[model samples]
Target chain A: MSVETRTDVPPGTAAPAEARRMLRTLARGTATPDRLRRVGAVLVVGCVVFALVSLFDGLARSGDVRDAGQRIAVVRADAAELYRSLADSDAMATSGYVAGGIEPADVRARYDADIASAADRIVHAAGLLPADDPAAEHIKTISQQLPVYNGLIETARVYNRQGLPLGQSYLDSGSKLMRSTILPAVDKLRMLENEALSRAYGEGIAFPFIVLVLGIAVLAGLVDVTLREQRRTNRTLNLGLAGAAVAMVLALLWWSVALLVGAAQISQASTHRTAATALDDARIQVLQARSNESLVLVARGGGSADSEFTKLLEKVLGPNDNGGLLADAQQAGVQVESIRSAAIGWREAHRKVREADDNGNFPEAVKLAVGPDPTGSGATFERLDAALGLALDTQRKAFDDNAGAASAALAGLMAGPTVLALIAAGAVIGGVARRVGEYR
Target chain B: MNTVNARRPFVYLCIAGVLALGSAVITGLTPPPAPPSTATQEAPPPAPAAGCEQQKVDSLRPEGPLPPPGQMPPGSTMDTILKRDRLIAGVDQGKYRLGFRNPTNGELEGSDIDVVKMIAQAIFGDPNKVQYVVLNIADRAQAAADGRVDVVVNSFTVTCERQKLVEFSTAYVAAAQKILVPTASGVTDVKQLAGQRVCTSRGSTTEVVLRKPEYNLDVVTYPNLPDCVLDLQRGRVAAVSSDDIILAGLAAQDPQTRVVGGALDEARYAVGMNKSQPDLVRFVNAVLEKGRDDGSLLASNQKWMGQQLQVVPRPAEAAYRD
Candidate 1:
């Protein structure tokens, strides 16, 4: 049984001849015990291979989860913050313009804050992206054009102080550049970051196909050896065989549990990420509406700015108040009930501002648009912004926590399987070696 | 961070605007370029047509005494506007001295705004009861024709081409198209600007004159001449061509730029109305007649345009062709 195949070594190979000599000496024993050593060798190799595959697979999944949680999340945050701050700066600048040459101190401070935040986000986003990443180019473009936009805005302010209409023209130029160039760049960067995030997420919780197959093979091989031992010795219990079988079952069970828990956590993180994205989009729309609202008065009803303001508001709140980005966010499980109401308030205030301006109540329009009043468009928009900001923060925290737990689910997954596999291999060797010694 | 100097954005905006408007003014404290040469505007022949009996400066005659405020004649345009509560006047907010919105108070000020008020006062007796619709140079006639506004008064020049679209009022202010050039350009006359790029507001009469093959000038039109001033400062064009009043506003904004050359063509500033509203035209003309008689029109002009234009003359006498 040990020498089941014909001796087929090449004629002039000393290594093969030496291997054969050793094989004949080992094969001189009875068939049953010689076969036990052969079966054990095959089982040990199977267990060791399964352990190696599990270790590598576990490490890969853990690495992907970590990357998603830290590096990808930070870059994604930078992209989203860039968008928020840029839109905020435009809205504040236009709204503050309605306050006239010498803006209110608080309005000025808010505008300054928006600009600083935008600049900071740009620097952070640029630093985070790899040099060769496509998003880096968009960041570069945004950084370069940001100053040009600021220069134009400053020129507009100067013109406004001097009571010149050229100030509005310069302001329009600045706004145009922001709309056409800088904002779009941020959009592209965000899109790229989102793709990277999705990729990391997919890898972090992917099914362990190769590891599972190897694990199953090891279990079946161990079962075959146990059956053979039982038949040869007429004893159902071989403690060594029983121990190896327990270790094999435990390894597979732990692997299954870790994979299931990690996948569940990743799915939860994805849901929160989706809801947060909707809130981000809705917030940007609100900021854009606020910008156009004041700019209509700034341009004094020229161009399509007034209509644009209306359209932006409608997109955020929906034309019939039944569906829009806010509604969509609500459907996605975000708490946008407060945002919707605040947006409606802002819309009402914006309507009054337009009415007052159109009806030649210029001072009243400016007051309503950029208010010290509690119910003005400015204040209403602020409330809505704060609400959206809070919602976004909650969603981000949920995503981060779930992602952290996903990586933690994979903790010890690699070492536990490898250690169990090593123990299983030792038991197989010991069990078969004792059987072979009895035959000798 | 931008790592900018300690200067605040407000100061930066002011400096940048000053540089753009008068790039050389702050650099060397260069004296403001010489005030534009005063030349009386020349009126061109009306656009020829097969059988049109329209005149550039002719309008309906004022009939009887003025209608009292809030008690306009029934079935009249003034009555329609009165019912609407606020008089809608189409004016440009970018015309600095004529109809600009004051950045200080967000109030629409300037001489053209005063004209709108004059009409508002006639209808409502409250000069502030006006809904200002900011129209571009191209939209002026369309605004009146479509009844989007009861009157258009943003330095609106009378022309036979526009006559086909909307009714006109007697000339309230006389202006002319002129050349505006950079001080350092050393180019003064319209002839010198021939073959060089010049900017005019889109749908402005200056575009027509500058586009003439004989002038051989490259004409570029913008939404407003004040916008053209941006182009001029950036050296995008050799000069800007528009009504003297508009050029004056641009010049005031940017002292480094100066209005030059004699009047290229004449323009008569008048209120525009829906062609179907002859009564409205007559009513507005009567208001202008009163302003001219009381010297208030000239007074408002002096207040707004006197500094930029260097001379504020009395408005022309009314002409009726009804």
Candidate 2:
């Protein structure tokens, strides 16, 4: 038996030069015991390590997404609360003042409570916020300017009680401060939080394709080596290599399925949660509109009602039916259709009041404005506000349900894969070592 | 010894794992407490005592119709005023169209100050002969108590509490409390202002009603009426509550506001005098009687408040308390 191998080819054999060179390379191929074992070890270890890295990287990013989503939800809620508080305080302040010169006890208490809540929420938001976040500046502005506005209001109160002509001007200044500075700052903070939330969701479902490629490569290598070993030894199977190959395929399948589930969850969250959040913006606009309505009456034709209030109403309800914030919310499938109609009605009532005032029916205008009549602007505004609030609640619930599920789906996934990866690596080493022992 | 050494790595690994788990659990169970914040708020000042009642009193019995100007009753307060060469009268310069100085021209012209001029005319026969002393709401009572001015006629609202502090002449002008709000303000009555900011002048009867627990209003008081009107115009306070006539003056100044709702309280304006000066009180009452009877009161009302008020001229009926 002359060791029928290419490396042992006779020197006189009439072989082409290319054929000889190819045979020499084949003789030095990885089929040799040491090379096969070494190559198999590398493939198995490489696959496990690559999968582990990909798993951990994906896991870290998913964790970040989950944390950011939760934080964004909290911060966004606080921001909205602050915005509502400021707006409600403004409306209540105006209503109270219109009702009387000195604020009624109930109205004053409500205003004070609103201010306190706004301050507290700002503090909480500031704490959760990044050091360099733009929202931090807005929060600072609210904090700093809130006290100033309150002081202006108190000054107005004192002056109003004294029956001084200057008190009305002070009250106007206070309202201006709220509209121009504080509310806008709060809106900016809300927008920033919203952006951060979207970024986190985008990062969470980012797929890691490298792990799949590495897994496939490792499996192919194991299959090829096993088939080669079977042919050379005339054996039907190598149990150890078969085991390693099976483990690699299983890991690949698990990673692929897990990624698909995560992606599906992320997609659902993006569509539903983001849309719901957009509705929140519209809901806030409704609140702002309500405040403006009250202040319009408070202004007593001081120009704010005609200019600023008109602009705000158009912004909230969409001008000429061409899609404002509420329209956008409707297109997004948020439950704001009724609110939209109510807002229109409120605006119409307001216009009627203005016309009455212009026509010199001052008493009639006042009655239309704040009267308890079902068709009055006050009642219509309350309805519109309530409808929008309900819509916001519904959207918030959907966001919490969907995003929360997505985030929860990722929990324990990281830890499970980490432990599995270590076991897989150990198995690859053990299985390959068993095969190498056959040569001994 | 070899067996024991072989198990050492496993034992050490187990120990490390347990320690790690134990420490994590311990740390998780005991979080660091948050630091206390240093922010605090100052306590508000205590509120003033309440329960002052609005009171009505009878006019003193005048000797008769007033004598001609410059011919005063000898050994009386009128003689003392004649000797002084000018009627020393206390007036408010801040009241709009009532006692306020005109910003356009340096002249004191208003309903209350007009009454002061009438008194001066009665004493020295010249309306410009009055030496004017400006008095605030608080100063009105003290001025009368200390005899700083001949009489305080600056929208003085009579109350049982203030009567204890200073004597008042017979009620000259009976003003009533009412609400003044912007045209757009839906508040039509004081009852509607239950939770509203209701501004009134300090030491005014409107303040008493606004501060009552039943009304539950945010009663903001200022030293003078102009400050309250300023607050209303600025949208700082909701509505102003004071004497209807005073509010009408405010409404007249600013077309944006109107006096709405009925009277919350009655304010009977009287000339404030020293408790010891009964003759002065009687003499001022006589002047008021002449003014009320001779249409001068109606004339002053027409001059300053006619456009703003629903004027129905009538004499203030005289009553004798003694």
Candidate 3:
């Protein structure tokens, strides 16, 4: 085997290796600043491009957060307006009912004003909302049904004045329409708005972990490349490139930290505090309005108004204390204690009114319902309404404060990132240009 | 060889780094699809209570043969009441004189209250045994049909539509549709109230008559006749329209207001029962006939109303024979 084996090598391979070695030796012999500067320029430009891209992306993300927050704030405002309009409408119904035959002029005017305001708010909300949004759909459904409900009320009023038994039927029908259709739609709208708000809050306050990581990575890469270049080439420092790298890293750190702080503030204001309180207060107001309506029916009789009211109240207010029918009695008591007391006073007034009715006292019941002394159910209802209004105002203020905080926290956030990123790009370009000049 | 040495490691590292970065970016950018949200469950259907359907059927039955004057058949309403050991009747709990609740006692007592008691006496022979179910005007007919109550005596006006659903006994009380206007209003009649707002309780015959173009009143309907009265007082409406009996009740309740218009239409009051219960209907008719003939009805009416009522006169032949 040793005799037959032969080591075959290409004739030019050794010669080529020798030539490459000679070239390497010669290059080392003439190791000059020009070739080193060319290599440094190439590396510097590549790093600068990567850093600039990362900075731009981070800036864009901040813009997205700010935009999301604004959208949520707008929707929240719309939800508030919707709630107010519905509450005002409920008040009007009571006022009109107590005023006898026709609602008082002022009451009617107030009713009209509420309706108009609600319509206007719906229009504005619709414009702001995407057509495909669920909230928009709810708004549309409410808008369509509101007119029908109003028409039914008008018809009921007409029949009632004619002394027709059907008047009661019409009025009952109208009230049913409101309960079944309009109110539920309002609830849906509120829910949808809340959803939008939550989504915005989430987007606005998203953790900046990704941007932070990228910033640290780029900074590390710059430091490593600089140290390597300095050690290998025996250079003291590449001042222009070092300055650009430092400027870019500092800008990234500053922008990222500021954004993180803003995001945290927004999360606290919008997600944790304002939204939850507003929703709770809104729900309470809805329950109170429903309870007031039920009490009216109880007085009417032949309507199972009391029983129905109880059932609905149970559904809305939840189970009562000591397992009684009025479980939420305490909450209701707190919210409308004055109204409850007024209800007691009204009952006394009603007793006298009933006696008068027995003595042929139609006028007496009418007088009791509309008495100016603030002792009637109507007056008590007004007091309860006032209380509810105060609660609503408090909730609204909380919402505004939180929403404003969330919005304000994001202020200058977008512009700051964009401007810093631009400055970073300028530094990177300047650093690369200085290296290129050394190559020249 | 030098070029290959320089390019090979860089190309491999670049590929590996790009793949890792690509995967990370894709994972971050595309969120997982959300799980299907549970929808809010709808409220469970209301319990299938016994009365609603039964009441509808009873309210639809055609009138059968009239009972012999003042004499009920065997196993009639009176006999059934004795058998069941309970008397159930529908009444109102809102009408002041007709039927109103006494908050002090949480008991319903009024003229209509007395009438139901009389029927109870006629049936179970004890008025106290009568179980009164308060119903609105809309539910009264259905309540009768559902057999939830043996009779509906909720100031129900007899009408053709109601007759189609339930068997009505002979009219025990006569009433007419009338307008209740504020004393200050110049409007006196339905004709004079054309284009003027008049309020009435819902589901009452008053709504139907007043809204008719012939009456031409700007009719307003309310959930209760009381609401209509309130509207009239507030001047939201010019008058309140409803059955004259209700109007009379209203007037009696308020001396400041009165039924200003003559009856717009003749309305007869009858006790309603399910059409399926012909024997019971016959018995009720017999009790009513006897009560009228014996002046018990007259006395009860006078006691509660503090005045005379135009009781439906018996047929001329029956009066002559008697």
The DockQ figures for the candidates are 0.15, 0.03, 0.06
The 10 consecutive residues of candidate 1 chain B with the worst lDDT sum are B1-10
Model 2 Cα lDDT, one tens digit per residue, A238-292: 7766666776667666666666676676676666555656556666666666566
Worst 10 residues of 2 chain B by lDDT: B1-10
Instruction: State each candidate's chain A TM-score.
Output: 0.88, 0.83, 0.70
Candidate 1 lDDT over residue span B185-298, tens digit each: 998898887788998887777888887788889878777777787778778999999878888888888889888999889888889899998888889988888898888999
Every candidate's CA RMSD? 16.9, 19.9, 14.0
**Model 1: residue B6 alpha-carbon error in angstroms:** 82
| Candidate 3 residue-wise lDDT, A1-440, digit = tens | 22222124355566665665555543443333433333333334334444454455545544545554456455656666666666566556554654445567776787788788888877887787887876777788878987876776666556445433333434455566666677777766766666655665665556554444444444454454455556755768766446645765765665656556666666555533343343344344444444344335323432233344344334433453122211233333224344334333444554454444333233454465455657654565456445545554554565456556545545555455445445544554565456446644
Which candidate number has the best TM-score?
Answer: 1
Error of 1 at B222 (Å): 3.8
Better of 1 and 2 by lDDT: 1
Runs of candidate 2 with Cα error greater than 4 angstroms are A1-33, A104-106, A130-134, A302-307, A320-322, B1-322
Give the least accurate 10-residue stretch of model 3 chain B, judged by summed lDDT: B313-322
After TM-score superposition, what is the CA distance of residue B185 in candidate 1 from its true location, in Å?
3.7
lDDT string, candidate 3, B1-322, tens digits: 1110112223333443465467569757998547358468775532222222211212222235444323434656556666656577778765655676543333567666776776667655667666566676767788888776778887787776776677777666676777777776666777888888888766777677776778777766654576666556557888887776677766664456777667688776778888888766665665666676777776666665664234422221111101
Q: Put the candidates in DockQ order, highest first.
A: 1, 3, 2
| Over 4 Å off, model 1 | A1-49, A232-248, A302-310, A318-323, A411-440, B1-55, B64-71, B187-198, B208-221, B234-239, B261-265, B310-318
* Residue-level error in angstroms, candidate 2, position B285: 37
